[model samples]
Target: MSMVEVQPGGASGMTMPAAPKRRTLPGWAIFVIGVVGVVGVLATTSYLTGEAALTSSSTMQNTVTLGMPILLAGLGGIWAERSGMINIGLEGMMILGTWGAAWGGLHGGPWVAVLSGAVFGALGGVLHAIATVTFGVNHIVSGVAINLLGAGIAKYLSTLIFAPLSSNPRDSPPIERFDTFSAQPLADWLGELEQDQRAVISDVAGLLRGLVTRVSPMLLITILLVVGTYLLLWHTRFGLRLRSCGENPVAAESLGVNVYLHKYVAVIVSGALAGIGGAALVLGSSPSIYSEGQTANRGFIGLAAMIFGNWRPGGTLAGAGLFGYADGLRLSAGPQTVHALLYAAVIAAGLVVIWQLWRRKWTTATLAAVGAVAVYALYYASDELPREFLPYTPHIITLVVLALAAQRLRPPAADGLPYRRGEGD
Candidate 1:
């Protein structure tokens, strides 16, 4: 027997090897981890409240239904930011598209209506591109103008096409937001779940299957778009040059990058995305073209999601999901009452005072102020206990969530600022 290599360290004095050193995570990695944690919390909350299991299918359907548009729209923002432009008129674009889509889908032939919406939206995007890129108008200002025009046009169209309630004018019945994945195969899986035999695992799986869905057609399109954006931003040589132009046009011009052309392409892409988002809502969701104030600021909420996502495609997706779910809260939880109102008032006040004192650096103060004002406003605005306000509680909560995202999100170094070539962050 070969002598075993028993060194000085015998069994009793054996020294263990040192643990491997941990690699430090990059900032973006940490951000992703944070997002996962948040999702876990929501998933757990849904499971515990029985809401996760009960509303799984509907919630999943509803989220994909709402999120597809927003996600697509956010990609547009990503394009603009990547190229050092901004498109604020997405809400307006959506409004215009909605009217077009709704009129066509509800009243006209299906294909004709959908095409009408897409074509009209493409035109709107072109106009935005021209104003921003060709005219060198301020990005924010141009977007605002486009948004205004879109909102006005959409409202006018709604009134013209949709009959008034007094005139027995029925606009349309909206599409179903909730759908079941209970195909024959899935039904067998769900049947076992419905029996409640395995309380824990069954409920968890039921909730997962029910409450989450693959992005439908619209979201699928967005996925393609994100891939496109990634390729455009990081892979292609032209994309590298285009990004250079946005970050430093003067320097890019020196290097022979076509600054003007790239900017134009970016702004137009943004507009088109916004229009698609608008179409998703009007054509895909609402019964008829709604006349009210252009869907109560979906554009702004989209802005919030962009901000919350911290200017990343993946992050934006999470932000959109969060806002969509938040918007669903009131719908999922039920309407407000005096009990809710009174309790909300006290809590809001307490929060406001506490936030003023606590110096947690994450824009908590702003949230506190907004929360207090919102509580008071919501309470007084409601005359009935359960009658929903326009666009309802879900919409409002979503808006809040969006704002939080923007407040917390840290934009890339060159995100909003017009690029000055050769400078470093």
Candidate 2:
């Protein structure tokens, strides 16, 4: 109605009106959204499954404790592979770490336990280094030897050290655990949400409380190690050279990078990390005893996580979290929880189908739809899942995901290849 503004264009005096700028989401926002989405799915699943109790602060704390070892082992694998070595002996190394921790605890308490575990792990690394790096033994064979040696040594040491003390050759005496610390006020504030109807919020609050308060020293160290490893691998001169050895050791050696020395260092660090993980496992558990098969194939799972993560630290962490979540779910499974989880799976599948369709991926969308339908049918057909089968859920997920994503997965180019001083790949 304003005749004074006769111009067709706006204040800019352009022929065409300017399009509104898109409010693009920042990277951090996107990441947060993704996290929230995942959390929401988990929370809903828990609530529907009547497993909401599993999402409490205490459970989350337990999850982190259980997940820490897996994370460490995965990191160890990353270190070895990134330097052109394959460490299949992580399980053996971890076993040594456990014995070391027990020995240390017996002698000097918690601090000594950590150091002893590290030392023992380093010893294992030394043997591996000698076999693979110095003697040119096949990496897998060397690892297997280390595993056999570690298990035998642990059992022998148990008899010599712990058997007399505990009267048991298969297990060691209980060790003191590190003190758990938490902010009382914060914990109290978060604890109030324990009974919240919104399961997601309640779960988040519980996790926050556990993480912020009642955290153990070992947990802090584990987190620090993760950050430190990232910096060491990506931001340091030595790290670059070490990574180069894994990529092309021949070229690296030509460029004056001591391939053998770096390989030795890498394997040593790998063992150290694995040792820390083993110590964490002992320290995090009840009675804190080192027993036979205590590691329970966590090392293999770590290897699987490494593969799932595409050999990156961040990716490895994510993979470990997923596996840990599955483990947690299994541990806390109930009739309600299982039912909720089943429904949650169907809903998740439906969301996947919708997401694919939104992206205009017809085939993918159709597949997702079919998958969703299949999940629903499976849930409908089965009245209930056996409780015993719950323990294998994580492993089953790992196998399925790997099978589906194996084609796109890539490892360091020379990850398992032998690097002679003058050889070419």
Candidate 3:
């Protein structure tokens, strides 16, 4: 008998039923799983080897310090892009903010310094809005111009104000450090450890002390800002209209929403956020002096983090935290620590491949296997991370992650498109 069965009183051949839909995991779920798995692997390794260097408090502190600026900048990027304007002058704005904060701190206090940076950053945003919105300049071109302007203006002011105070015009006078409070009893308790267990206890204590004491107000402010950004972008009426402009300005305008006004506001707020990021750097991180290049491409990194997080405040925080952790490793780890991490990553990748293969996910299994092999190859090639490679680790991670996730990432439809008044869709 033939395998095909004929339908009674119908066609000569019968069709097969459709296959069931595959139950794919949500992106956020997958991200959380990955995070948990990585943490588990690191924890396991630490416990087995009795090496807590990877999980030290100093590393955690560094992560927070480095992640703040990136997180702020990412939030700024999210705002600008969500309002139909692409503000790539964040770096320049941050530079101005650094200088502004320095000047303000010298004259007033730390809090005033933050306000001054925000004002300067808002000025940069105003310039961007005038170019892109009022004059119909290309967004990218306007951003580049603003960057040049910010750099030139900062340099000029530095020469005028800082030259007499410091030997180098590029360096400003040291400002009073931010106020820091510590948990004295906890710190003391952690300090009272045996010599054999000192490293681990101290690392743990450092983390507790960092949390309980010596904390800056800027850190709390940054946390509040992240939460506020989330609320403003998702729950507010203004946010809905601003997002509508990014999604489809023509539609928004037809619905009585002023696209131009919202875009201007968005871009301006973006600049203010970037400026605050700069202030956070100086007040929370440095607090000593303003130096040229202190922003150090953190604005660009923030942009990358925004993309990595798909332009959501929560996601951006996760991305920034990840990058910050990587940077902390680069800053604190010696050769042995690096080697251990590399091996751990390779093992994790291999285990993932095995799990995927077991689950019959052929494509994922293959990719994981390839990643494991590549990482192992890298491990074999470099016994120790070269000191010179430290600075590029974050950038390299940004590039690789973006490359892998680009196809799955989506931006607002009208993000980079120009909209003019009375222009028909």
Candidate 4:
């Protein structure tokens, strides 16, 4: 005989038991876990390959210097996209900025260079705004036009302005470098600790040392901008309305928001930021010269970084850092250190397989497992990657990151959509 249990308050007033709550790690815990994992991977890779550069202070220093321009460009993308415009002309704006910075530096100094770069970049933004917002042209078309126009204009200006000064049509004369400061005592202490080479402790010391030593004022300003962007876009009233235009402009217009004004401002600011990025490239380099093609498609890379970050300031910084690290490794440490990275990738892939299996994603787990095995086999067979391939490492990283993050990406609902006043009404 089967016995039936009575429901609460009998059948008429039955209630189901509460479902179990899912557990998740807190933000700080997740951050700690990530840091620990990274340290572990680096330590293991260094030990296995006998490569000290993998976690050296110099490598970290180079990472910051190289990553700053990309970070600035990514920030510019964030501003325009957040306000409902896709500023694909960021590349063009940056090119203009490089020329502006060089010209300004030659006449005045570093600060003048920064200001000139911003102004030039803002001018590019104005062109974009007029084409996309005022005229209702296709955003992509407008952006491409800006890119071409920017290149042409830069070349023309260089020939007219820089040729007489530098005796070369494509190169600018030397510009003043930015002043840098360091926490010398802290740097010295960390240097000694890094020299000790005590696994995780030494690695952490090296990383900290890079940050405290020979720090640029622009780096501080960039950090402030990142924080400022987060606060402005998420916390302030103006930011809300601007973001609203991107999400639903008709509704925003109905609510008395000046969508056109906000879009124009956003795009202009975006250009200014991209211009600063270009300036950073000129000033940060050893010789402080603006050469033709110096932007090196970093604007596009910045766009990729913005997407990798899912259009957030903090995320953009992380994306830029990753790209910068790959680039720095290639430039500073060369092939042997990069080869050591293969071993670290193998371990990371193994972790991915385990994670996918735990989630019961059989296809993904199988793919990850296969990938891990394949990477290991490659590591076993190859000594080092070709030097020629090193230059593309950052781009490769960008592609891989975009692929991994594609499923989670969510752009603004009304982004890239043309808006005319009264249409929402």
Best by TM-score: 4
Residue 265 lDDT, candidate 2, scale 0-100? 95
For every model in order, what is the number of clashing pairs? Answer: 8, 8, 4, 0
lDDT of 4: 0.88
* Each prediction's whole-model lDDT (CA): 0.59, 0.82, 0.81, 0.88
Per-candidate alpha-carbon RMSD to the true structure: 10.3, 8.0, 5.2, 4.2
TM-score of each: 0.68, 0.88, 0.86, 0.93
Q: What does the lDDT read for residue 144 in candidate 2?
A: 94
Q: For candidate 2, which ten residues in a row score worst on lDDT? A: 1-10
Give me the displacement of residue 382 in model 1, in angstroms.
17
True-structure RMSD for candidate 2: 8.0
Candidate 3 lDDT by residue in tens digits, 1-425? 22545586776677555556779987568778876676667655555445566666666677788889899989989999998889899988888888898888888888888888888888888899899998999989988888888889989999999989887899888776678766677655654532234444444454454455456777888899988988888899999999999999998899999988999999999999999888888876554677888888898999999998888887788889878877877777665665566667777878878898898999988998888888889877876777777678888878977876687678988988988988965
TM-score of 3: 0.86
Error of 4 at 208 (Å): 1.5
| Best-first order by lDDT | 4, 2, 3, 1
Candidate 2: list runs displaced more than 4 Å. Answer: 1-34, 333-339
lDDT per residue for candidate 2 within 1-425, as digits (tens), equals 11232355445433544556668886346546756776778777666666665567766776687788889989999999999999999989998999999989888888888888888888899899999999899999999999999989998999998999998998888988899887888888888886665657887886677577678889888889888988999899999999999998988988999999999999999998888888888887788989888988787788888888778787777777777766765665554455455666677778878887887989978986887788778778877777777777778878966775587688888988976787753
lDDT of predicted model 3? 0.81
Q: In model 4, where do residues sit more than 4 Å from their true spots?
A: 1-36
Model 4: lowest-lDDT 10 consecutive positions: 1-10
Off by over 4 Å in 3: 1-35, 45-51, 183-213, 351-360
Candidate 4: tens digits of C-alpha lDDT, residues 201-249: 8888888888898898879878988888888998999999999999999
